[model samples]
Target: MNPMIRSTRLALAALLLTALAGCGDKTSPQTASSRAPSLSTVVVKPETAHREQVWDGVVEAVNEVTLTAQTNARVLELPYDVGDTVAKGDVLVRFTDIEQKSVRRAAQAQIASAQANFRNAEAQYKRIAEVFSKGLVARSDLDQARMQRDAAQAALHAARAQYSEAGQQVDYTVIRAPYAGIITHRYVHVGEAVQAGPPSPQPLIGLESLKDLRVTVQVPQSAVDAIRNHHHAEIMLGDGKRLAASKVIVFPYADPKTHTFNVRLLLDGSHASLYPGMTVKVAFAVGAAQRLLVPVAALWHQGEMTGVYVVQGDSVRLMQVRVGERFGSRVEVVSGLAPNQHVATDPAAAARYLSSERAEPKA
Candidate 1:
């Protein structure tokens, strides 16, 4: 080969090698930046969390009553049925009032007759007293007129009492709701005979006020002490809503048969929309403990595996974690996560970053 040609080939090969090295240096920074991208992360720490003890409970109305008949009569009109909402003073039941009306009228007539007789007797007694004072009549005759007047006055008093009692009976014939509530059950239909007596009063209807609600829980004997002492609880509704109890009433006595105490948790007026007889979860705050917490958005669920992206320097890794109760936006980390570890706030972005990093070829 010629010396000049050999020199030119060598020079061209060296230039090509130098250009390839320069391009590699420029692309290396982009690859490094893509592998270790910035991610939003939070430092895991222990928080003061309440250890809740949950149990099944039943909902009941605070103001519930079973109305019974107070007057003997046949059912005439039943304007309201079960599940019907009623306002205060609304007529609930109307009985056949024919007999009651007749008795009331008779009492009114008796009162009138008694009044007329008393007025005549009073006039006679006044005339007799005047005559006796003027020495025109005997003392015995005046005394007899005074006695007759007193008897007529007594009869008038008795008649007035009878009239009042008769009116009360008429009022009892039309039963009205004592408070605004919803009808739960109807014991009698129209045209049924109900009696008001000593043996067992007939129950007419069942009503419950929705505004005041309570959660009744039969707590086991072992947990009674803690529940009674803390006196703090929450009602877990079906839709994942939680309501704090306004008041906690632990019954003093435990059931003799079951040996469990009755706990009543009163709910505030805000939850009036809840219906009665609903099963709810009652979470009683038994004690407090330190627990690791992270945002629920950071969790990655794949089949049965639950994990989170933990940021380690410039790399993100998925670590399986045992989760406890959910506290609003954050969740309890029972295990697998340590304190002060940086956790990626967004799992999806961390996952993408990890995928891209793994796909890159090794230098």
Candidate 2:
């Protein structure tokens, strides 16, 4: 055999062996570090969570009223319309005052006449009493003058009362808001006829205060006793906002039809963007429990899929989780996840890391 041919065969055989070794390395399993890149993560652990009985509640204003017509008049001016905010003592409606003013003036005139008659009767009685004391006039004349003076005094009192009442009637023609609130409804319009009386007075306007708000919940009879004893609750609003109730009120009697008792939760101060007739969830603290909690930001969603990027040693994988009630920034993982397992806190960062890892060439 030639030496050059042997050397060339040996070189070719070494090249083939090297190629086969490279292919075998590609089929081997990847280590933990090679599967996922580094990311900020948190450990899943159990926390003390409050166990609550949640019920649907309706929001209502603490100070709400409907202004009704107190006197017969034609509505001349309506200064406010529905959805208008009003200050205390602001004029809401103004009615024609011609009839009321005329009555007031007549009563004033009557008062003046009554005052003059009473003055004259008093003067006459004094003169008659002095004359009778001096034995210059009969006793009957003195007695009659005294009686006339008393009657005149009584008539003057009646006239004054009538004048005051007439003034009140005139005041009733102009309606004013009793407190600061939003006008929810305007039942009477400008130039509308409003009557006050027997069957039912005409509703003029409706007002509700937004500053002081309360949530009304119809609780079942079984839960009423517990709620009454506890008297602690929180109102759940949109955007994950929770408000604590300042006070709780439970009605003694239950509804005849539903067998539910009325429970009211009064909010402390002004409610942020809360309005009447809004449905909210009220959670009453009943007990406590241990729950596996993870930051809400860790949860990932893709169409119908929901899971978290769980970190195992140096590797991170998406694990589907069954979540229960949400507690502020954290959520309870009911199942599909175990305690002490680390999860990526920043889901976007984890996703990016995973993408980069998958795109890299395998070792």
Collision count of model 1: 0
Q: TM-score for candidate 2, please give it.
A: 0.72
TM-score of each: 0.74, 0.72
Off by over 4 Å in 2: 1-47, 292-363
| lDDT (Cα, 0-100) at 45 in candidate 2 | 83
Q: Lowest summed lDDT over 10 consecutive residues: which window, candidate 2?
A: 23-32
TM-score of 1: 0.74
lDDT of 1 by residue, 1-363 (tens): 899987787677555433322312324311223345688999999888777899999999889999999999999999999999999899999999999999999999999999999999999999999999999999999999999999999999999999999999999999999899999999999999999987988999999988888999999989988887788998876554578899999999989999999999988758854788998888998888899989988998754457787776655566778897777667788998999999889989876775576567766
Pull out the clashing pairs in model 2. Answer: none
Candidate number achieving the greatest TM-score relative to the actual structure? 1
Candidate 2 at 226: error in angstroms?
Answer: 3.4
Question: Candidate 2: what lDDT?
Answer: 0.84
